[model samples]
Target: MKYLYGLLALYLASWLFTLPADALQQGFFFWRGQLVQLSGALLIALLAALLLMATRPRWLEQRLGGLDHLYLLHKWCGIGAAGLVVLHWLLSKSPRWLIQWGWLTPGARHAHQGASWRGLGMELGELAFYGMLLLVIISLVQALPYGRFRLIHKLGAVLGLMAGLHSLILLSDPLRNTPFGWLTQLACLLVLVAALWSLLGRIGRARRVTGQLEVVSHPAPDLVELAIRLPRAFTRDYQPGQFALLTLDAREGAHPFTILRQDPDTGLTHFAIKGLGDHTRQLVQGCRAGQRVWAEGPYGRFVLPDEGATPQLWIAGGIGITPFFAWLEALARQGQTRCHTRLIYCVERPEEVLHGERLRQLARKSGVALEIHTRQQQGLLDPRPLFTDPQAQCWFCGPQGLGECLASALPAGRLHHERFAFR
Candidate 1:
């Protein structure tokens, strides 16, 4: 569905490219001005990508209304912008124009000696366009695996710089002549500079903090609960439903983990880790107490809203219950206990339930009904009962399959899923 939405948006926007270059000049703005508008759309697309990268998960939900939709919109908009840029180029230049301009000449010396010095500028713009194309193509479905996406995503930062350069070199006259044109140029320049900084590895380094693992408690097999003492300056904490990536080895990349508990008194960050893979399995099996760990967080936008009417329905599958634990902890800290909260935490086996006792204790204390379902005992998690009672704002985290199941069963506005795997 997301892919379809994205492709459809791109297709609709691509029609903008089909317009003749003289169409804008026929009635309203010139083709140059239309290019500026297209550039503005590109700028907006870049800003959306930035928001997707930088915003915390919990804040994103509230700010963007919902992340899944925003992500879908962002993806589609980006693809459309890429297509428009292609259209813009095709409209701007013809094969005969390239030949006449002598940009297709074999040697650099021939380009220098040509009757048209415009060849150099055209060549540079073409190079930039090709770079943007490469970045956009890699960002799509292909070349995503084997860590190429990270490198290609970084390469995407160069697109803005290239586009800005393209704008400056090609539209210099309009840039200096009109206020709107100048504003467009300035916006592109600012965004381009920002992108350069990100390329230089500056943005991600800004909000990171180094902390030590103060306590480690394995409440269940293959799961490790950690209490991390954060730095004093890192005082402004996150909401209950947020998540962060824990970096035990700063030398290595960060591992995404859900925040299970936050100490209101001391401002310590707590994370729950399930030994799912090589990294986490090692962390659970080898990491000891008092180990120094850097936390690059807190991200994620899965939260119950404060809107007094939306009854919260928490559905956590397997280790997905970690973030909800933080919710309970935060609610308890606030001293506002409500009975309307319905927690449906499910696990594969009865013994696989980590921190089950603590969750039940919190549910009992807060007057929230705790319904536990063990797949080994019941065969499957029956979603019929959970969906029968509508009017519940469902916040869920689990494997992608279960999340999709809940999404299919619930209305658009009702289901909010947080993917710990992706973002």
Candidate 2:
């Protein structure tokens, strides 16, 4: 969030300073003129960035620390851009209300110098603005299903192209010829390319691979464990705690799932899934053994340190236990988890503890200190008692409330975690 906001602020300040001296005239013309370029620059820049993030580039994910952080930035960039659009519209229209209220006098209307494509650009920009706003509002409705949200969200690329064209055509002559004009033009070009990439459905094409589901079992009523034979994909080394966007059913789209275990010798991977949403519920119910499955990348950065000497604490809540399953299995494969490592799993019921016996077996083989806290028997977790050392490093995956409570009570830099949601 800070990275995205800081980038926006830096862009706005730099662009503002690049404005020519004479363009700094006082009164309505100056404000309106400045507003035009400022709004256009902001909208084009932000929307372009949002579209770029949609491509899910692996390098950007690494730079951002994890896929979780990258998705968070992507979501907030869209939201921030949408909000700025409203503010821009308000400022653009405020003069009319001011005039009606006699709070200001109307200046004489004159032909502008760089209105060459004014008629076309104005019409296109207005249409695109309203359309983008509608799509964004639809996207924000929590009641809307994921499919509906995705369908509406794709239209943003079309509107983004329109917005890019609008910005390129309507930039004032003063800005059109300056070095910053070249920068704006480059930004617009990138937006055009990103929009086309999105429209063509090339977002995750490169990393996509196909496999066959080898096994499926209901570990519990709501828990599913799947083993897949991804001979091509599994040839590459994958870190424990990494996940994939799995496409068991094309209609449901590729949903992210953490890799629960892996068979390096046989090119197989395992996933433990719990029905958390409509799409996930569909996956839980509709999955079949021996069916074709598609997956994209072993993505994420929730990996344990290879060389840290300090004792480490790992916490998992509900389905968040999936990643740690892979971690523990990896530790077992390496002979043992470090003596300093510990894992605490919190669940509401014994029925929801995914593969309790398997987890215990893995812990025994890996030498990890394991703790399970159930609501019925142990209530909620209080880490303060366990957090005796301030130098200890903690990695947590759980409900937001649990993370927040733990963070607030613990040492500032001790908790290391990211929300495992798009937002």
Candidate 3:
């Protein structure tokens, strides 16, 4: 559905750029064909963006579904709208005619539509257009991997404000006199306001849910699994496969970490993090209890029970076993504990299997058929035989290359995957 909506918005934007020039040229008071098309496109794009922001489809919550799909659509709609507006300016003779009337300055001779200072309005409009273009590009594809994208994404708000100002100053005449044009411009202004409000609202809500990270024990060398205890109002039973975004300070950016354990009885959420990335390295070194850490979401759809009724084959590679640990814990909570589960755990060295005893206990308790493959000693585990079993449902969480191997080896419907890529 999101893919369809993105295509529709793109199509509308293109159609708007090609609207007839004579209609707007004849009478600015009348509803020109170009104005009508542009207005429709603007409204559709705005509404679609709003819907994507607010709607979280139920089916998407439990599986690797349409969450990313909707976000991509929202992003593209913003880009397409900016591009169409640029074309709209080029097609209209307002640029040239304004220059002839001394509206532009000599410095604007090349870029401006008109020849004089009165044409300075064109300069402002062009400035806003370029600003919007820059913001759209950065948000759509340039900035990525959160840490790298943070500063630029923040600057997007400034670009948006510039765009709103330009529209208000230069396009006011056509907008005020024509009902459709006025409504479209008004809607754009409202979108800008709504976006700002939603951002602030999310930030405030995220701040309020901040908690303290308490170190239970340093089980592994240079590795500390912190049990972050959230406030009563914020602590809810999270699913075994979801993760939370954590930030030590409200001003700092968030980093996602999987919820390793969920104690329904105690209401404690655990995060097992190794010293990796700028954030985790700092976290593993010194982050302590009684210090506030903001947390947002129980995001991601990477679990077993939610994937429908099917016999399971759980594959874990190194620390990718985070979700598997939670799944095992969830099984214990349910108390229907015969582990008829299959686990193919692949690690580099023997010492890398940190939770071996617990896994053995889980296998014994729940009837899980356990298989431990050490690549350093025994080479890579063969996944072909696992998929040979017709009843098996393969789930993988690790490297994309490894997932691709499993995806190609298994039947399409039988395989479920959750890839942990930074970007």
- Number of the top-ranking candidate, with lDDT as the measure: 2
Clashes of each: 4, 0, 15
Residue clash pairs of candidate 2:
none
Deviation from native of the Cα of residue 183 in model 3, angstroms: 9.0
In the range 1-423, model 3's lDDT, one tens digit per residue, is: 454566456655555444457655654424333453464436334543533343333344333252333344455557666666666555454545656898743232233322343355456556656766676676667445556576555554544544454444444333344554455466557556644654454433533477777655565655567787787665564668777767775444776677888666666778877765666677678777777777766666675454345567889877677888888777766764534458888877877775689877766666667788889999877778776668778778766667888888887787776544433
Candidate 2, 11-87: lDDT as tens digits: 67767777667655578757876786777787787888888888888898888888888878777777878887887
Q: List the residue pairs that clash in candidate 1.
A: 57-300, 57-301, 58-300, 58-301
Worst 10 residues of 1 by lDDT: 106-115
Leading candidate by TM-score: 2
What is the C-alpha local distance difference test score of each model? 0.65, 0.81, 0.61
Choose 1 or 2, whichever is better by TM-score: 2
State the TM-score for model 2: 0.93
lDDT per residue for candidate 1 within 119-160, as digits (tens), equals 655665677678767766776755355244555666656666
* Full-model lDDT, candidate 1: 0.65
